[model samples]
Target chain A: MGVPDPADAELVRRARNGEKVAFEEIVRRHGPAMYRFGLRMLRDEHAVRDCVQEAFASAWEALDQYRGDAAVKTWLFSILANKVRRYLRSQARSVPTEIDEGVIHSPAQHEPERRAIAGTMMAALEEALDELPLAQRACWILYEVEGLSYRRIAQIQGMSVDAVRGAIYRARQGLERRLEAWR
Target chain B: MEMSPERDLGPPSDLLARAAGELRQLTDDGWVRAEQGVLDRVARALRSARPVRGRHEGGDFFLSSTVLCAQVGTRVDLIPGVRASSVRIVTDDVDHLDAVTLTVSVAYGQAIADVGSRARGEAAAAATAALGVQVRTDQVTVDVLVEDVFVDEARDDGGADDAGED
Candidate 1:
């Protein structure tokens, strides 16, 4: 469902021509979404911001090499994903490979009666998302929240399209099972 | 590899669709504010980097084009009764023959020709001063948009009295 952004393309062109403001405009447009993606992946607010900063710096350095083969957002996401992965690896933080069943089953606490259902469902969803493996979580977020196609997700994650589809499928099933009460 | 059954793969599309809708509602207001800090860092980094390449004083020095555009745009913006929408610079093979195209919206009751000329002069001057190179006046093109007049400020000042009288 994503369409090409003509304004972004023009800004990219100007940035390539050494327009700082144009590049800054590009940063303003995509930075928030990139930060959100990084936060979802790393789950560390500070780390995510640092990773996004590094990603944009790297993108600027490599601006001339960008051929526009993919949308700028896709390109930026790929860079941020890789940066987050590298940071996680360097920190030696163990990413849980298995989904935590306990989190899935825990009942929402202190929820208001009026919006109990929606609040409980949302809480369950967040817990289920947090329990997913990094790869699957990234796939789900990109495909579901970001509205990226399977092909774009595959490219960003450096996997085959079928692999991306499989990851999304697994993530969806896990969430569905966890939030079956809401359904 | 053997294929799994469709049932084993995931939930039905409708269920996943509902989940996606609910998840999209989540927001992080803090991250929105944090983005400005990241942008500031980016702007500083870009400012320090060399952005333009040209021959200066028989030697060569680089100027950041981002800085150059901002300077040009700022100058054009400083002119009352007009706002610079976009500024783009194109250089020929020698890099000395620089051409600038500026898109601007002129306020109503302002002469388009005068605003265009002033924007052109200001942009060229700003580029010359910032780039340390003489930018030719003839190479600048001001693309004027007469439709984008700011009526709110005019209305507050009673400046649109003539239009109101009609």
Candidate 2:
């Protein structure tokens, strides 16, 4: 077998010591998930790209200060979350619930009828998610879609475990009411 | 059956489940291009960014701590069984190189003491070459701290044994 890949902690340790390649390897490994998270949170193609890029740039600059208290993935998500918040503050505008053409298209788009329905459902869900308070949206996405644990979400959100639980609970209620038509 | 507005979160309903799945599968036309863009930008920034600098002007010349630590780090990494994680060069008030500290990780089963000695020697040599000052006259000090041990997977014999150490 080929040489085993280095652990994330190992890469972080190497990165702390001024190894560019180690950090780049980290970017390659985690960049896709980060992209997905950004797309779901920000919903704007340009905004997602910018947030992911800036998150990584900030991560590289702050590598020395990383204490490894949290998993590298958790830490990265935290940084990306902060960047997303900063982007939102700088804009100070309403969260756009509209689905862009570039966001997603059904793989089975050949069926016109099915594609239209799928598009509607996707847009509806996006709208429902967008209606949530930013904190609830972030907490819900991280917990449900990303499958991160409560503790991990708490660390990323800088909230207590109980607080994260409450946010997620409220998020579920909001989504359920918003999407009740699908029931 | 009536539904209560105040209800505990249950397992995701069918719609919510599908929505979550769709979120997980999100992709865009520009995803691949954007990811490459980020990597390229980060790599370029790293190459051009000057992280920290220590400049000391002697009678006729100046020395940079950033360059000094980088050179020292390279030298330390060249030693057989150790990889330098961080290299620091401390400059005195007059900008003379005062001390160097090297944090390193050693390969599993390697001799820690030997690795530390070689790392110190290489670091000192590199600093002297960079600063144009003799170790004795400048009183350059080198400290080597072995902070971790890593398995040499390339050298492994491909055994089925897993010892749970990285």
Candidate 3:
């Protein structure tokens, strides 16, 4: 068997002491998750990529100040939430956004019938998500899609846990209404 | 008391629940396609943020303690039965070298003293090579603290003594 990699706490300890390779390990572990998060939050391909890159850059610069009070992934999402909000503020964009369909690839593509169904459902879900307010969508994605705990999502969004639950509840209701055809 | 919407969140709909799972899969696929490009951009951005403070070697030259610690960590990790968890370089006033502390975890069944001594020697050599400022290996004060002893699960020999596994 291959040697087991060190835990995140160990990596963070090394990174705090100025190990670029350790920090790189962190990026490798969390980058994909952050990318998925960015895509869910910002439908545009370029914007999502930029958000993930900027979040990592900020994290690397602030490694010295990280106190490890929260999970590394949670801290990363907090930084990413700040970057996304800043980007949104600069653009002042409207809701009901359109995603770049070309970037989406479904794992069910091998089965043609399954692919068609998944494609339709995914399109509907994306539209439903796009219609949600940014905060509601973010709360829903972080809690539902990313499987983050409500407390962790609250930490990332700087809101009360009750507020996160409320947002998720409303988002779920809206999604249920919009995607009723698929059920 | 009024029932808050949050508290009244009924059983999640099967369609939305399935949609959430599918969204996770969809986003994961997209991320795989763009992962390399994103990481490359991140690496490029961090290049300019290297540590700035350093000990003046001489004649406008300096050696960063951060750099030294990284090197020490790399070298110490190469030793069998030991893994470096943290490496720190201490400098005195006037920016002179003070001591190097390496916290490491030793594999179960390996002699703790032996691993620590080997790590100390490697750290001193690494610091000397990294600075290259006429400092001898013997002049470097190296401390290796055994913060943990871990089971080398691959080599599970049961006759071990004093594993001190943490």
Candidate 4:
């Protein structure tokens, strides 16, 4: 019911009942967004894609846990978010935080404000987003962009509403600081 | 237990918001494909999960054997508690049913004679015909195990089988 299509419920039912077609629909519908969302958060193309795939695989196995209360999209994002967190934890050991100034703050930052379009101007925003602590970035994405309520966002991020609010505030502050000139 | 219902509006950048929207669409579409793929796989899995009968074929022959069981067994009874969900024919040894004695499981309350039992025989005959096997009815020894018993007072009253009734 939470999803736009009753077909989603039917798909969920079939998936729960072991229908492969239904499962495929779920994957196809969510896979690209999953990768992109994970990519935006994780910033490593390979790691983000892996996390997205891992999340779908995990959701496939535990599909019965989908109560239809939250949209399957929401449930999947939660899974993806968890995978990203785990990835971050693993990477914390091998590679210290190193910002890719070339891919991000390259000579491209020289463009004037009037030409400051989302297509180009958001590179620093993206870098700043990528640079954020994973939790804060997740909060910002779910809250300000995805338009999910703070409560649901909190559930996905494994943080309290107050903490989520703080994360969003901090994420916003971080973004504004990086793009202060554009404002 | 550590779960909470906390929420957030995400990062306050409008461009990022738009990007996330576009990203969500992309993810949703991709997942639709993934779901379809998984659904196909799951359907294949479930279909394969059906109970396979015998080393080769002749699953339907079991029903024919059941019929033969009903004919030869001392007890005139019916199967109970279920219906004929599905029936299929498979390969069998040419003389598989020749003097083969087996117990037949059928339900009483859940199956009607003309529907379940009769249909079962019909299916078995079809299967036998399909296999090019002419079931003579004499070559098979089927013992119907009457697991359920009930009084059909109409038959017990003998109003129909009574030869005296013109």
Q: What's each prediction's TM-score?
A: 0.57, 0.60, 0.59, 0.50
Candidate 3: the clashing residue pairs are none
Q: Residue by residue across B40-121, what tens digits does model 4's lDDT show? A: 4434332212221222253432233322322322122232332222222222465254432222334434354433444344
Best model per DockQ: 3
| DockQ (Cα-based) for each candidate | 0.11, 0.13, 0.18, 0.07
| Model 3 misplacement above 4 A | A1-6, A93-119, B1-11, B47-166
Clashing pairs in 2: A17-B85
lDDT of 3 at A99: 38
Residue lDDT tens for model 3, B39-110: 676566542222323334455345666566667787887898887876777776666667788889889889
- Candidate 3 per-residue lDDT, tens place, A88-147, comes to 755553335653332222212223323554558887887778777777888899888887
Backbone clashes in model 1, listed as residue pairs: A19-B66, A20-B66, B52-B63
DockQ of 4: 0.07
* CA lDDT scores, all candidates in order: 0.67, 0.70, 0.71, 0.51
Better of 2 and 3 by TM-score: 2
- What tens digits encode model 2's per-residue C-alpha lDDT throughout A136-161? 88888988888786667777777766
Per-residue CA lDDT of model 4 for A1-183, tens digit only, reads: 123467676787677556666777777776665665665675555465556666777777666435443567767788887787667656654456664322221112113321343444455566677667667778777766566766567567766667777777777777777766655
Ranked by lDDT from best down, the candidates are 3, 2, 1, 4
Q: Which stretches of candidate 2 lie over 4 Å from their true place?
A: A1-6, A93-118, B1-10, B28-30, B47-90, B93-166
